[model samples]
Every structure is written in C-alpha cells, then in structure tokens.
Target: VSEELLFRGVLLGWFDRLLVERPSSTSLLFLPDDGRYARRGIQGEGWRRWGAIVASSLVFAGLHVGNGPEGHWFGPDLLPLFLLAIALGWSTRQTGRLTPAIGIHMLLNGLTVTLILLGASSS
Candidate 1:
C-alpha cells in the first residue's frame, strides 16, 4: 500500500540508515494512526468507526509480526508497531492526504534510527 510505503518505508529505512551511519544517539515515537486521525476530527461516531481503526491496526501489526523471525513477537516491538499503524491510518483519513502523516512518521523513524546508532535507547 502507498500509505505503508510512504510512512513506514521512509521512516524505517531512514532510521536503519541512521543506525548504520551514526550509532550514537537518537529517539523515536510510535504513534497510532487513530491518534493522528483523532487529532483531525475523530468524534464519537458510534462504535463502528472506532472499531474500524482498532481492527485495521491489529491487522497491520499482525502483518508486521508475520514478516519473519526478524519481526518476531516482542513486547517492545508490538507496542510501537501497533501504535504507529493506528496513527498512520488515522492520519490518512484525517488530512485526506497521506503525506503529512508519512512525513511525521518518517521523522519519528529517523530519530529512532539515529538514536539506535547513537546508543541512546530503543522505544
């Protein structure tokens, strides 16, 4: 999906690069798409909309988990991935444009990778 590619791909890839190049200090956040969406205009539209995002996020996280042992289950890993997914999905809906969310996503990922390389910490 374009959404995944732009947000996750850009952020994750950039962070990975930072880890390899810097490996000194950085940080990252795992925001859910719903959070982003909520930031825009997510109200109490009944349980349907709320349920939709939740289900979608779970599926997104599950796919990541299914990737391989590299994407194996880990409390730290799952939490962030799920949260980020929620943010990405929600953002796309909120702004009616995936670019902003992807940009923010990439920024977080970049910081994360940089931190990893810097030996700061993993989130």
Candidate 2:
C-alpha cells in the first residue's frame, strides 16, 4: 500500500501531470465522452508519456539498488528491476489509476517472497 502510493500514486502521477494531458478539462470533467477516455491510456502519445514512465521507472530502480539479495549498484538484478518498474508504470498509465500498478507490485512481491522461502526450505 505504502510503496504503491508513494511510487505509483505520487511519483508516477506527478510525472504524468508534467508530461501528459488530462483526458478531459477540469471544468467539464463530469461530461462523458463514452469510451474515449478509457481508450486514451495516459493521454499524450509518443515520447511524452514514455518519457514520464521511463523517468519514474529509472528512479524506482535506482532506489531499490543494493537493497535485495541480488541487489547491487551495478548488478544483474538492476535490469529486471528497471524493466519491472517500466511495466508497473505502463500499467498505471493504461488504467489511468494506481490500483493496477499496486496490484501488480503486490503480486510480484508475493511471488518473489514465496520463491525465496521455497528455495530456503529446499536448501
């Protein structure tokens, strides 16, 4: 909850606001545009939203370095973390909400922890 709120909610949202356009204007937010908004992903296309996603993912990966079992400043784990962060960011944008990203984060963490526990037990 906290991680998702901070990274996907705060950081991603901030970057998105800076780089992407709102699906609808604030003054007419209540007005419906059918499925248009739903299909829009994160609004702006091309490098705009991609820039925001990549930037946020970079920060996410950088902060996690040296923290986990395989984590290091320049280790093999960094690439996966960066890639995962990118997927999380992309999911958040696709849903136009933090819930999907949060869910993905939780699911992945659970899987990783379970795998670690299983490996330890096997050893």
Candidate 3:
C-alpha cells in the first residue's frame, strides 16, 4: 500500500508533471481522471509519457536492490524488474489511477513471498 502510494502515486505523478505539459486540472496525466488519453493512443505526449515512465521505472528498479532475485544493483534480475516497472507505469497511466498497478504489485509481491517460503531461490 505504502509503496504504491509513494512510487506509483507520488513519484510517477511528479515525473508526469515534469514531462507532460501541464497536466489535467484534476489529475496528474494530461487527460482528466476519466482516462481519455488512452484511447487516443498516447499521440501528442508519447515522448513525454514514455520519458516519465522510463525514468520512474528506472528508479523503481534501482531501488529494488537486495529485494529478491534482484539482489544487486548490477544483476540479471534488474532488467526484468525494470520491465515490470514499465508495465506497472503503463497500467497506472492507462487507468489514470493506481489500482491496476497496485494490484499487479500485490500479486507479484505475493508470488515472491510464496517463492521465498518455498525456498525457491534464483530467478
């Protein structure tokens, strides 16, 4: 919950604000909370949107060091974690809410915990 609020909510929101040209009146992304921009296919703000997502996702992956199979800053798991962050960022942007991203995070965390409990190391 807290991670979602901080990373997906605050951190990504901050990046979006910086990259996007004046976000919507009520929300962080260009469109309103209604997620209108998604159907339009990220046309005008493609670079801005990807810029924010990639930047935030990089931070997300970097901070996950020692958090799982991605136990080091320089490790094989970093790429996958970065990719997952990208997916999470996309979900957040497409929905104009953190629910989908948070749910995916929860599912991944749960799976990680289960794997740990099962002593299934090495990704």
The best candidate by TM-score is 3
Residue-pair clashes per candidate: 15, 0, 0
Query: What local lDDT does model 2 show for residue 2?
Result: 84
Q: Please provide, for model 2 over 1-123, each residue's C-alpha lDDT reduced to its tens digit, 9 standing for 90 to 100.
A: 788788788887788788776555763478676766655654445577788889888889988888778656778778999999999988887888888888889898999899999999999
For model 3, residues 62-103, the per-residue Cα lDDT tens digits are 888567554565787789889999999999988999999989
| lDDT string, candidate 1, 1-123, tens digits | 465664444543343344323222231134434454443333434344445555666766766663433556654567777898878767765666657666876787688778767774543
Error of 1 at 60 (Å): 2.1
RMSD of each: 17.8, 7.2, 7.8
Candidate 3 is scored at a TM of 0.74
Q: Residue 3 error for model 2, in Å?
A: 1.4
For model 2, the superposed segments whose C-alpha errors exceed 4 Å read: 21-45
The alpha-carbon deviation from the true structure for residue 51 of candidate 1, after best TM-score superposition, in angstroms, is 2.5
* Pairs clashing within candidate 2: none
Question: Model 3: clashing residue pairs?
Answer: none
| Per-candidate TM-score against the hidden true structure | 0.50, 0.74, 0.74
